[model samples]
Target: MTSNPPLPVRPTRTAQPGFPWQHFSMRFSSTPRGARLARRLAGERLDAWGIPYGSDAHHTLTLIVAELSANAVSHGRVPGRDFRLCLSAEGTTLRVEVTDTRGEKVPTLVEPSDALDGDGGRGLLLVAALTDRWGWYPCADGPGKTVWAVLEVGTT
Candidate 1:
């Protein structure tokens, strides 16, 4: 079984040392629309941090968020629940996390078979391919999960 550690609750105050790290977060309904919003918001947040839209780093991070967020909405959605998108850029490393109210469905990465088409069954695979490292952990409440990925950004 994959080991999914539990995540600590995010404090109500954002005062931890190096805490903010240029971050932004939003909770959206766990729907297709929410997934789209997560991707757009990620780009906007990256832009605010000076990673312009369409830039390599921005594009890569957006794509990563897109896949992970979509997976959460599609595979991890729970009725009446929402998913969250959080972005943090510290120095050159940009961290992105998507959390959903589903703890049982941990993400796994595997090579896509030739029989698989590019349009399907490629989301997590793409995430694993693009992210420096990625994994899932139980949400602080113990009833949900969060999947996170990290990407390094620098002048291209």
Candidate 2:
């Protein structure tokens, strides 16, 4: 039930806002390899934005992306359709958004005890624990759902 983040308005088509923000968005095939590639590329983008590889922020964000991506591939996947990952970093707040082509499988954080059998299912729990905030919503642009996580890079 989380709301979508507001995007800055631009007066002119060629004008760029003077804000310290970085964004990366890409669509990937809804496969395990695609998820892995998304995670790696996300790390690269964060590093290019000065978070650097192996830093706490870099690691946390990467993990969040990986978990979200895995969920997109495993649960939300629609065969022949692709998933999308959108990343936006503004100052200390880094938001990770992964959208997949399935609306019925809304992500829910289950009880830890219920999922502690170790056959997986800890992804969301780990994301919830490591991130400042996280949630999902039905996609505004298409027929799917978007899972998101936010991290405060400065605090990490």
Candidate 3:
């Protein structure tokens, strides 16, 4: 009879009650299609996390991802590097972060466009208006940056 290897032991931890922060991260090519995918995936993930379909939190978070992902693809795209999207829900607040490989390029928020002209710069502006708070930070690993936004799940 062959001896089996020792069974893996599972560590016991005190279970914490109440709200848990769930994290989801994904990478996509820096392209228009990739940006759209990021937004759709975010909504799906939020639904799976029990945030409720068509809730205020769900729509706001989805829009935030759409804008950030668009900026990443359009302004922050590097030659071969991909962009990353990370979403996490902590307590009643949901945080969305989109990171791109270009560090030299940064996005700014501005007043909403009053022009009837097409192809205007208004992505970040919309993000600022929708999100409770939003900002960008240099990537800890260097050579990239992360733009993040936070919104209250139920509170406007």
Candidate 4:
């Protein structure tokens, strides 16, 4: 009996208008230093994309990247696996996505607590506060998840 050939794999693509879209993506080590580098690189890219370094949009995006990257490193890290950072800018909205190698540790927003003595567990809180919207999803074609945040320019 002859076995059928394996089905061809299709690459995933994001829907976009005919207009040009700007995007940047990179993988970083799953470490604190890597998180720091993600924030720095994103900041530089934002500045280059006409968002001034000290503007509200720039600052907010930087904070979002910092928190999300930190969470990926702390909660989603796997040995010998690096996390991925992706940025896409279309029109006035910028989307930041960080994918890590731990799919089971999905992130959820937590209610604010009266007690302020905790040593950790506030990364998502910060992300929610800074971004216009944020969410997480398991990778469709891999063994990990991506945490994403979106910020709109000129929005408070």
Candidate 5:
């Protein structure tokens, strides 16, 4: 059997955390369609980085992206403003960041979305349960906030 060739930008699996070797960033319209695209592109990017499409890590990271992107489009939308999606791989961890222009409406795990009794407030809750850690903060650039999640990815 032949060994796989080294990739130009694949991060070392044991490298220090918080330093990514591969990164992908893009801005999408703050619409449901844009959220869907973010999820798909994020999955594709992970696959290109050697994670493959059907692996546990790939599925997990993609799910987190979907939830975050959906939230950005739903609660964080700012009329004509678009949301941004950034993905990076550092060591064995994958980090996803979704930025939208509505910093005033931050997400809280304690209460989640609208009504606790309703079926609409569990997005962040699902994100919290699935990922290793997740949080949000005002964007450093301009207006809006950045919701982020990190998952520890490993071979199954």
Candidate 6:
């Protein structure tokens, strides 16, 4: 029987000093299936952190993850490269970041007139509506960028 090769491991950075935090990170293929997995895993992590499944924070964060992950797969895909999802919680803030290997395709908030009347161009809008803050930065290590969203979760 033939054996499959082990997947490549990706580096994950943790939080700096002064604040206690909980973190989870993983990389997924730049495909629709990977995006779906990102959303599911984020929901599971939030539940493990004591955020109830249906709470405002849990629901909001999950939605943000879904939208961001979908965008990464659709717009930021690089052949044979994967996208990354990172979740970090410190105090009342939950940060969600999705990184993809397409630095030049930096996302911008859609202007009212530019948005299509249909289903397209609404991802960032939902993100903006639900999260406390959202933005993106070009990755310093290589040819990619990380888009991040912050949501405020109340202590249980």
Scored by CA lDDT, what does every candidate get? 0.80, 0.87, 0.82, 0.84, 0.85, 0.86
- Count of clashing pairs, candidate 5: 0
lDDT of 5 at 147: 92
Across 1-156, the per-residue lDDT of candidate 2 in tens digits comes to: 899999987443111122268899999999999999999999998776777676777788899999999999999999999999999988677899999999999998878997797687788999999998999999888799999999876652
Clashing residue pairs, candidate 4? none
Q: By the lDDT metric, which is better: model 2 or model 4?
A: 2
- Write down the worst ten-residue block by lDDT for model 5: 11-20
- What TM-score, over all chains together, does every model reach? 0.80, 0.85, 0.81, 0.83, 0.82, 0.83
Q: Summing lDDT over every window of 10 consecutive residues in candidate 2, give the lowest-scoring window.
A: 10-19
Tens-digit lDDT track of model 3 for 10-101: 34322221236889999999999999999999999887776655766678788899989999998999979999999998777788999998
Q: Candidate 3: where is the Cα deviation over 4 Å?
A: 1-19, 113-118
Which of the numbered candidates is closest to the native, going by highest TM-score?
2
Q: For residues 1-156, what per-residue lDDT tens digits would candidate 1 score against the true structure?
A: 899899886434211222236878899889999899889888887776677666667788999988888898888999999998998878677888999999888877656883275556777778777878888899987588889998766523
What range of 10 consecutive residues in model 6 has the weakest lDDT sum? 10-19
Comparing 1 and 5 by lDDT, which wins? 5
lDDT of 3 at 108: 69
Model 3: colliding residue pairs: none
Tens-digit lDDT track of model 5 for 32-65: 9999999999988887777777777778789899
Angstrom error of the Cα, residue 90, model 1: value is 0.4
Global Cα RMSD, each model: 13.1, 11.2, 6.7, 11.9, 5.6, 10.1
Q: What would the per-residue lDDT of candidate 6 be over residues 33-133, giving only the tens digit for each residue?
A: 99999999999987777776776777888999999999999999998999999999887788999999999998988875678766588789889988888
- What lDDT would candidate 3 get against the real structure? 0.82
Clash totals for all models, in order?
0, 0, 0, 0, 0, 0
